[model samples]
Target: MDAFNLAKQRYADLGVDVEKSLQTLAATPVSLQCWQGDDVGGFENAGGALTGGIAATGNYPGKARGPAELRADLDLALSLIPGSHRVNVHASYAELGGQKVDRDAYTIEHFAGWVDWAKQRGLGLDFNPTCFSHPLSADGFTLSHHDEAVRKFWIRHGIACRKIAGEMGRRLGKTVITNFWMPDGFKDTPVNRRAYRERMEQSLDEIFAVAIDQQCNRDALESKLFGVGFESCTIGSHEFYMGYTMKNKKVLCLDAGHFHPTETLADKISSVLQFLPEILLHVSRGVRWDSDHVVALDDQTRALMEEIVRGDYLSRVHIGMDFFDASINRIMAWVIGARNTQKALLLALIEPRDRLRKLEAEGDYSTRLALLEEAKSLPFGAIWDEFCRRNNTPVGVAWIPTVKDYEKKVLSARK
Candidate 1:
């Protein structure tokens, strides 16, 4: 209590409200991706390898084999992390009843259990249409496939997934964001690129043709530069999605790891918000390509959150995780990634924005640079430690032993 008071007074001296920051942080929700639990292997029982430029590297023991186990693992993770949050589900993670069902024919009934689970836990939900690792998308193209049959198949899948998202929001009494990301591209440079993009434009129009109330479900389209097999060209490039979003007044998803090596999502947040009403961010780390490495409290991560806070776009920018690393304990991976995201946001919230903004506006570059560098060494760790105590989460590295115990008592029993 004494240390926390000192830190609070220190922040107060800088004209930053630490209590307000914690309150705002508590209200903000980070959607945790479910794919990390099972390494993108959903409950369809599709005994096939992941295709379309997506791959999970490790063969970690005790991977969630079904919906129930996955939910339990998520519960453990949620317990360790502070603040309210949501779960991001892929269409592939449906609760099929041992009966074979295709992605296109999916319905809200398949996800009833998930809704109940989330509702019980007082958590919000987000969804994505899984368009890869299936027969129709075997050729590395889905929404932009050259074949009419393949294109329509993916279109139906998108439409169905949107409706499911609507139902989730309707029942939970909160708007659910259904994001669309397809691995539609070419392994080699195609003779004609416009043809594929044209098909994609038409397919997206058809999928969004049915009027679903925005209050129930909001639509977001994601773009990518390249994937494992589709290195030559990606149909849904950032330019394409930005244009579509502006015209349609829908959310444009900017994935952290989906862009070129040199580009960062931080610099694009304000620019995108200028044109679009809202934006969704898939927070992941890319080593060289879109590797989906677990996120850390790095400089890039801090910059991303700082941009959001400084721009006052917290409400407009939705934050969600999109990485999957099977090398570590999956539960700990979720905790680490989620905590780091929250930490970054906390650090951003604690910044003396008014002072910096005034300096920038008045052209006091020297003082601004000095203060910015000085802030890096502030007592942020003390506030973060107090935040964990307030939220009843484990402080610092204390949560690690809990995860290891769970691995021994639960995960190890799976095999």
Candidate 2:
């Protein structure tokens, strides 16, 4: 028998259907972040270094300088990755045609090109408000600024982005999830913490009050424990967004790298779903800090996927990539991160959870533990290769040559 056939029988013995797992993985969509191609440096003329307590290291060659090149890179990356997916965009990445437009003034016209592109590919679109890397946000505040005018400016931007997202969804025939993640916090200890949070609360309310149809656009708030400069305190802490999401009945985004090193975001999935209707997950690799690194098929990623599948919360959870690594080939980084994410999900889908649950019910902890370890040794690689073959994507290291060739032909032309 072929390797995949043998592995299929092995999984069948454990009461897991291999074909059903593949079908599930094929249907689930992972929203690919647009910033990865340009290292969070959007094509906006509002030029400045990366701010809002974030940085993408390394000066890799062939970085996408404009919308056309970014789209081209994405086309290649998407071709290599298996399964259909969505593309996530930040407001700063709008195609303005050299026209000067500030954040608050942004409209769907700026992103009509993106909507057109997604429509052609039958892909869904997601959006963010781009609350960092601007003169107004240089003081480390956007939505929660001490200045009421500054807060109002950001609030308008948020409302405008939501309208654009609605249009994107309506045009594409898929719901576009708009995630609001602002880098508003203090570098030092603040004498008044509640005041800033209160301001943030009011700002969020004003932004969300201008609601469009949920089918066209849904809202989500992402929280961060701390960033590089804002180490002392983050106004949008986990507890803050938790309360806000629960009360407002909005989707909550749980970034894997946004919490402390000891806190696994996988643990928060089941807990948050109790109150909120759904969740938006930011799948990123944080090395010590929120140092957005390329994702690999590691234990953390596996555990995260396992939790979603085991709890039967796949439909309720929206998965999206949130890492950027300029240290490597930008295209390669995108492929590696995205492919690993899907691979981890495939592993999670193929897991014999029913047997494990039954073993747990019977208090066969020792057998359950032994079987879990043994299951990991199965020929999962064969199944994964077969999946790639079925999807017409390159198997194993076969895709690497395509990236290198693209780098030589397309990337090398960029200077």
Candidate 3:
């Protein structure tokens, strides 16, 4: 069957009303990180500091665009995909010399402006504060004890940004989701690294406390009925603060690709869901060595993964694509990545829980594998076609020409 029919049949079998399903689907917050081009040559060229080789090769088609152009490109690309409403802007101001410099003011203004622009388009913003700009963070944010100053600096920065973010949310009626990805762990002295982690949690407690106070104030305003709520979703390489905070204020954002190779993704999802049922997700794919490959979702794996994600806690789920591509046309990469990830999520949502449960109860690896194989067999193109048919909406498609194609086109035009 086509995707729309499949979705309908699955929903019927699962006893989910189609109208309610569509409403839930429509309400789902889909976002993408704006810093993908930070390390690559792009519109916001920081004197080539963030450009990793694409610009050097002279193949950077998007290097000349500014922040306005980048935002426009994102707007156009997102309009092509279905169910994409949120865009995460990476507001790492450490490039401006931390809190001690005047650059922090400029960075905050830049982000506030972007947040306002996105609000006009009815999109939400997810903020990742400055964490990856210095060698002091080579160990990780919230995980480095040796650099007490760096930790303290981040705490201050977090508090300041929380205020700015809270103000922006109040003005725009959107929640500012702050994501914390601490690169705090040890490669050699794993035992000694425990102290570093402890300090990290302490720092996080302070940050989370501040975020809660700011959000409570924002959530209390009656005249400003924007329905926005602030959340500090912590993404870590390890479960350092699994059950540390109360519900709704601080939550864990599981990065599906961040787990070790030995740990099953399904098991990891189940463990986190069991402890904290309502959580956010930073979705991506990787192989043995690479952690973020930006590859197409593996059908069988994603089906089972989605089953876990759609349990009692699906409403609390916020989706964002975390991938790094050094290509020049970062906009096109973001567009394709977002579209593919959304398709994967839709399929997972439509799959029946009982069917999956039966396969799991069989206790045979092949039986579970077969179920996933069936889930993966659902053709994405067919599904897209069906979605358009059922919704009576024309598909918005973009033709992002590759580097070679662009080169040939540009040269031919010059002649």
What are the clash counts of all predictions, listed in order?
Answer: 0, 0, 4
What is candidate 2's lDDT per residue for 1-415, written digit by digit as tens?
A: 2999999998998899999999999899999999999889997863359899998899889889888899999999998899879999999998888888898999999998999999999999999999999889999998889999999999999999999999899989999999999898889999899999999999999999996999999999999989879999899999999999999999999998899999978888999887777999999989998888888899999999999999999999999999999888999998999899999999998889999999999999999999899989888998888888888999999999999999999888876
In candidate 3, stretches whose alpha carbon ends up further than 4 angstroms from where it belongs are 1-23, 38-45, 48-60, 63-65, 93-108, 135-143, 185-187, 211-237, 243-249, 354-381, 388-415
What's the lDDT of the predicted structure labeled candidate 1?
Answer: 0.92
| Candidate numbers, best TM-score first, in rank order | 1, 2, 3
lDDT of each: 0.92, 0.91, 0.52
Winner by lDDT? 1
Cα lDDT for residue 305, model 1? 98
List the candidate numbers ranked by lDDT, top first.
Answer: 1, 2, 3
- Candidate 3, after superposition: displacement of residue 330 in Å? 1.9
Residue-by-residue lDDT tens digits, candidate 3, 1-415 = 4556665665575454455545555567667766554433332224434310111222444432346545655665565556647776555422332234421243455565576677788777766654443444534343345677777767766566666567656666776666655444433334454566567667766766664344422211000001011011222334454544323335566565555555555555556666554455666664663235464757534643475545645665567776666454555666667666766666666555566676677777687677666655544455555554454433545244442354355322421
Measured by TM-score, how close is model 2 to the native structure? 0.98
Question: What TM-score does each of the candidates earn?
Answer: 0.99, 0.98, 0.73
Where does candidate 3 clash, by residue pair? 139-183, 140-183, 140-184, 142-200
lDDT of each residue in 121-163, candidate 1, tens digit only: 9989999999899989888999888789989999999999999
Model 1 steric clash pairs = none
Q: How many clashes show up in model 1?
A: 0
